[model samples]
Target chain A: MTHDLTTLVPLPVLIPLCAAGLALALHRHPRAQRTISVVALSLMLAASLGLLVAADGGPLVVDVGGWAAPVGINLVADRLAALMLSVSGVVLLCVLLYSLSEGMTESADGLPTPGGEDPIPVAIYHPTYLVLAAGVANAFLSGDLFNLYVGFEILLAASYVLLTLGGTGARIRAGAVYVVVSLLSSILFFVAIALAYAATGTVNLAQLAQRIPEIDPGVALLLELLLLLAFGIKAAIFPLSAWLPDSYPTAPAPVTAVFAGLLTKVGVYAIIRTQTLLFPDSPGVDRVLMVLALLTMVVGILGAVAQDDLKRLLSFTLVSHIGYMIFGVGLASEAGMAAAVFYVAHHITVQTALFLVTGLVERRAGTTSLDHLGGLARVAPGLAVLFFIPAMNLAGIPPLSGFLGKVGLLESGVRDGGTLAWVLVAGSVVTSLLTLYAVVKAWNKAFWQEVPAGVTRDVRLPRGMVGPTTALVAFGVLLTVVAGPLYGYADRAARTSMDGHTYVDAVFPGGSERGRGESPEAGGGDP
Target chain B: MNPEMVPSGVLVVAIGVLFAAGVYLLLERSLTRVLLGFILVGNGANLLMLVAGGRAGGAPIAGITPVDEMSDPLAQAMVLTSIVITLALTAFVLAMAYRSWQLNGHDEVADDVEDRRIARLAARNAPVYRDVDQGEAGTLDEDAAAARDETERDEAGDKTGEAT
Candidate 1:
């Protein structure tokens, strides 16, 4: 059945946001709140799928309050957006299920409650989780740049609550860093948006696509640079990524999973949108992106290598791998953008799976430190397998999604035939080898060594936890096998991105040429 | 376009100064000072926004004034949005700080100087174990640094233990 736009577009964002209010109000009723959270997310998943199918090649745009383009707020969902929303929905579902199980068991077993009075710490978890999910969904679906900023605010606001959900000292200290850095980034993002709107007199992506090209070369560069800096800080590129590793690993496992899964990708998505739609040049912005990608790759992986904690190592690896996707964007060709899209999808699944596996490690070993954890393979072969597949994939081992994505990126970079492209190709190759080493280090230290004494090894995997972990792992594996069809989708997405005329037409029909304000020939000679 | 009026470069320098100050104060021990630093930094960023948008308009909304006479109202709207977000962020941070003080008995990064020092001293005082003892199976590992620190604190019978 065909989906109605009015119902589908708004519900995906509105349901969880509404559920956040509901969850907060029903704080005393733990089960009711949890049920409501699940129901809201489930509906979001359905709606996201509906929109994805409906908006495969084309886009779905609805101007809120009946305002026309350039004046009113619009919510547009193209294939890339739809793909992100679907990925976010799946990850949120997994995280929610895992949280529910963890919360229930902890509540029942007399785990040291946060407030000491509330036996079930349901009051805190439910509302915050719902809000975080709502924020993520909003971010994925938002059309206008300002609207996306709002979505980011919603997500980060909820994240502030989630990061410090438990008032532990470590969580508090880490939460402080998270809040300050995030605040700074938000401020920068606001400034960028303000500058962009001033320069172009428009905030809508399609409208900005029309106006930005006509702007002076210097002005255009400033706006693009400002926006890039804001997004870069959020995306955790090499120099901008210090706060992430320090803060992310300290939060609860489920929160960490969701954050790792969806948040940074939103930043990457924004960069891709701005780079492709706003400025399409062979060497101008693409060169800068290429440098950032290479540095982000090399530095992030090296940081990962130094970390003794599994979660910290993963966090660093997270930053390192962002380079691959950024490299894809840097190429600015159809294949390059396509490879980036493919990498983003692959990275989300693999990264989220790896974080969830850390949760499993935390549970079985009683600590996430590589020094403290050992012989997990012998004690818990199932958990070992769970970790191994994604670990191998993340390292770009053969017959996995990571390998397919990197190969696509590398091939595209090689074909692009620029100095930046060659650097990206070589950087990714080096990153892959380093990533493999880091993964091997974690495996050898945590899974292959002898177990310490006085630790009664409970290798028995929890029924509740294993389900979500297995599902994520299977999804990553499926991406590997289904690379052909997935690549076809990416190919279409990349073409639409490169040829902004298609996206502009999707947003403003009969005004396609009108939307491209200044022709490339009229502008600073194609940079 | 008037360099004799407001120099945009000064605003950039101001943003740099504000960011430097914010980063410095945010790294300080006191939570309150950190909050003030953030506020300053935020204001500086908002000023930067004002500059970036070409520094030439009142607001972007229509119907309030003559179309030709009106300023870039978009920057004004952005300022309003940034103000709202900053207020919300400040409130959240304050709430977190209050909650943290209640939980940990201090607003400083380190919860208690004396206790932390004592714990470190106790760790220095304790004997290190190279090998895990099989006999200690089922019994908690005394050599476990974290657990040992906890035991040391418990043995010290300090006032900080009561906070927990």
Candidate 2:
């Protein structure tokens, strides 16, 4: 009478992994491959939703190859993992749908339609996109450090292909930098894992949690630092964030939006996991994190302010706003972590929505350069309304998810009232103001002002493309409206992550570090 | 313990030197030098990992327990993974260099700030003629002809000597 819902755990990873191979096979059969990719992704989205429902009250752990605890790698999906995965699934589904609707070929209306000379085939874009989404899901669900590294490689490999899909001169050049930096970070991650393994003899995050405490304090600190450096590079924390804005804006709108929305946050998520689970006792890490958070905020927004290109400006702000999440994590309070988790969810939606809106703006206005785009509201009032809500939310205005996430972090920081927390609080307020200014600058230039004389009227995006952008924006606003439920989920996730014992016991049984923790039979039988 | 006690300390210092030099070269605009810098950084990071693995002795293989030590196999494995990834990246970046050289006729990084300003200026003052041709021309491929038509219109308008 077993329903075998746990079988769903590996399906999300397996589907995409298989799709990557299938995608390569269908490279020749472009249409069939696209069908397979889209179907596979849709199934994955459905599976992710089911897992979310099943995991509503508790953690779901899948031990691979039927191996027992501590030896077999595990994939654990808790509330935070489930929420991130759900958002990623939904957003990617929208992007894939939009890509299909728009047709893979055509340059925001600049290129000829399909069946014309040099058809822009959907084949290359769709499959690689699925692979990317799959990698994101794997990263979110992985319970082992080494497995997470592999997930990152999967994502990076697919992104490298996607980023260079067009093989344009600019794209190739940008992809080159993006690929190299990502590879370097991956290597660093390997090094960090090696060190951690040396100290703990295991790569399972749960096992490491129990063992890391026994390792020499100095060695543990060194390992933590190495791991932090690696993840920080990926997340594009203040100092290591330089490669992002330069590379992201070079890709097509969907590619850029997905990368901006999901990829860096993966890095941030990794950092959160490592700090909370692996080295919770690492002294002075929070202080370092606080300082880095502030710098990330200041430098990122300043970079955004200086950019004239709408996409590039948004990209900078994307990196800058990462500081808020990092700040919440650095606070190391339960409220702080919950706020950080909520912020991650909120930012992913708003950021993705904004980027998609930018694509629409580019399509209608002939470019994303604010100076060149003026008075867009006059001709494209639909676009103006579409872009405005997320734009205001991004600047942290009230009733939106963005503002709620920010307020959560600021309140936690202010409540903590340490010097680092004070700095974070002050920096949060300042960065929000600066963020508002940057977004308004874009609005004034692109929407409010009179349309410049030289602008063309020929730019017309398909209904399919606009539909996704509008949907994501509406979805973000909905989250803002339904803040209570989302916050409760985030709070639960934060509490569970900090508890560590609940997570620890789920992977082990009597072997757990939790004193009163329930065993496998008491909850769900291991068999 | 003195920092100079281990003979491998020199290798560690060498790693530092590689890092500093690589970072300096990476900052340069030239593509080849940047590639070289990346290689150097890779090596330095590898050395750093190896050093962190503990005093190196012999090659680390399984089932070997020596007198108080074994060449930290974990570090060796880490280095191996990193080496493979670095090799892949090096090959990929070289391909990029080749393509960039083919397209731009130079391997230096583009001056993004300066180019952006120029692009902004050009976009801001785009002629009235550009807009008119866009109305009639269906695509960007006909952009040049569109610009030409718009320029002709502007000239004709100028000839009429009426400012609208």
Candidate 3:
């Protein structure tokens, strides 16, 4: 059964990549491009779901191109990876559908005249979106450190194109800041990987997990710090987050929704993988992480509270909610890790749904500015319900997955009983309340306030656009309904990751020294 | 670990200098300079990977070079991959920079509109400085008083005048 599942490991990455090539080739045939993209992503989602179920037994590892663990790249779909892959697959599919529907309406409107020419280059969008999906899958499933880096580059490259899709003045400016910052982070990550290889003589994650403990404490700490800094920038942890709000709001709504949902979460996922699998017991680093998490929550929400633009406000809230995941990781306990994983899943759905709803608002109301938006509740009652559910879910109102995840984190924090954990607990509650304030402020302005002049209320929302968004919001609600089993699976995943040996042993079943590769020196030579 | 595989001091220094210069250039506002800085830093990182592979040796060929004499093939492979990635990214950034220039007539990184707005607000709300604390020569307090409701201020002023 495990061997059978291992064959499915590469499908999520492979199918989309192959489809991307096909999509690019068929760019002239927009219908064919759409069909190929939809089919490829649906198959990827199926594979991810299969992996999610199979990986629950244990990690399923595949050595790509028949190369073994140490010498060759591998993809491992452990529980955490499988869970992340599944959520991302769902999100990518929904966003793709939303964009496709959007493109259809846009073409129908005949807005792309001689000068304006379609803000989103429709021909390239499918291929780039597919590549982005593949990249995200690769990042989640990669068992090798260097392969993870490759995955990051793939996704980031796609993101750059998406962010500056139309090459408008604002998008170009936003893309410049985004591209520069991401490049810097990538460079830092590369440096860290190089140094890690120097110290450990291997870039394979399983081998590193074995060898890292034997290295000098100071060198190990340096590697840890370097990796954290690199991932922190990607994850947009407090101090490294300024670029996100500025860059994200400039993109088209579907693109922004996907980025808001998946991109930074990839960084957070990396942090969880490394901190749990590679460096499991460092209280001092954990303490520092706690402090940073506290600041990220407070500062990010404060920024959110101050935003007049709805997209920008959502972006800030996205940054703020990342703090909760960091808080869970900072606790460095199984319970905390479980809650973090669950919270990550919850946040991805809720945040994406909110952004999609914002897109619908922009379509119906003509803008996403809180100051200009008004009477949406009276104008579009269904849209109001859609926005209200996800908005409340994000703010962690009772009976929602967001609230459940937060409660789990807070419970874990109290159990840890450390002063820093206590402070973070307090910080999280305050952040939650402030999030409520920010979203409510947006709600009141956008939904309840009198309609601003010159804004049309009679615009119709296309069924195609609303269908996928509604499905996604319903998926968010489904997370609340299935919270029990999901949290249980998360707990088991947390246990497996925190233990570390299960992952390493899965990669090198016999022992730490050898893989199936024929190379005499399976692991790399030492410096 | 091999005793003879120590990295050269000169190489390490070169890496440091490249990184320092790259970071300095990175802080500049122009997208062109930032792209150049990224290329420099990327090269420095590639060199660091080379250094990580230990002392240079013969090409890592199975039959052409002995095992002991062969350089670390893995590091070389990684460096080559990174170099390709950096090159691709360089092309993309160049395109973006050109696009930026075409759109705005310049390729300088612009400040975030929201951040700039906040900065402007902070400047406006900043407290004014006065040389003398008690003097009424355009003091901040006097300004506040002048800005207050005229009727309320007159009543308070009359009361204070009577006390004086």
* TM-scores for all predictions: 0.84, 0.83, 0.92
What DockQ, between 0 and 1, does each candidate earn?
0.24, 0.13, 0.27
Model 2 residue runs over 4 Å out of place are A1-3, A106-121, A512-527, B1-88, B114-164
lDDT of 1 by residue, A1-527 (tens): 23355357667788888898998898888889889988989998899988777777377766565555555566777778887888788888888887776663232112222234444446878777777777777776676888889889988998888877656566776787778778778877876776776566667888788888787888888888888888898899878887888788877777888888788998898888888988886377788888989999999998788666788889999999999999999888899999999999999999999998898788777778777788888888899999999999999999898999999999999999888788788989999999999999889988997776666756455777889999999999998998998888888878877888766766665454232232221101000
Candidate 3's C-alpha runs over 4 A off are A104-116, A519-527, B1-3, B122-164
The DockQ ranking, best first, is 3, 1, 2
Off by over 4 Å in 1: A1-3, A104-121, A512-527, B1-29, B45-74, B100-164
Query: For candidate 2, lDDT tens digit of each residue in A1-527?
Result: 02376677777888977886787777777778767877888888888887777666677877776555455567887778888887887788777766665565654333224343444445567667877887898898898887898788778878887777556666765676687678667757876775676566677898899888887899988988888899998899999998898788877778888888899999999988888888776549888998999999999998888766788899899999999988988898889999999999889888998988887787676677666788888888899998899989999999788889999999999899898799889999999999998998888888887777877676677898899888899889888887998898889888888877777777775565333212222223132
RMSD after CA superposition, every candidate: 6.9, 8.9, 9.9
User: What are the clashing pairs of model 3?
Assistant: none
CAPRI band of model 3?
A: acceptable
Best by lDDT: 3
**Could you tell me the lDDT of residue A437 within candidate 3?**
94
When candidate 1 is compared with the true two-chain complex, its DockQ is: 0.24
How high is the lDDT of residue B72 in model 1? 50
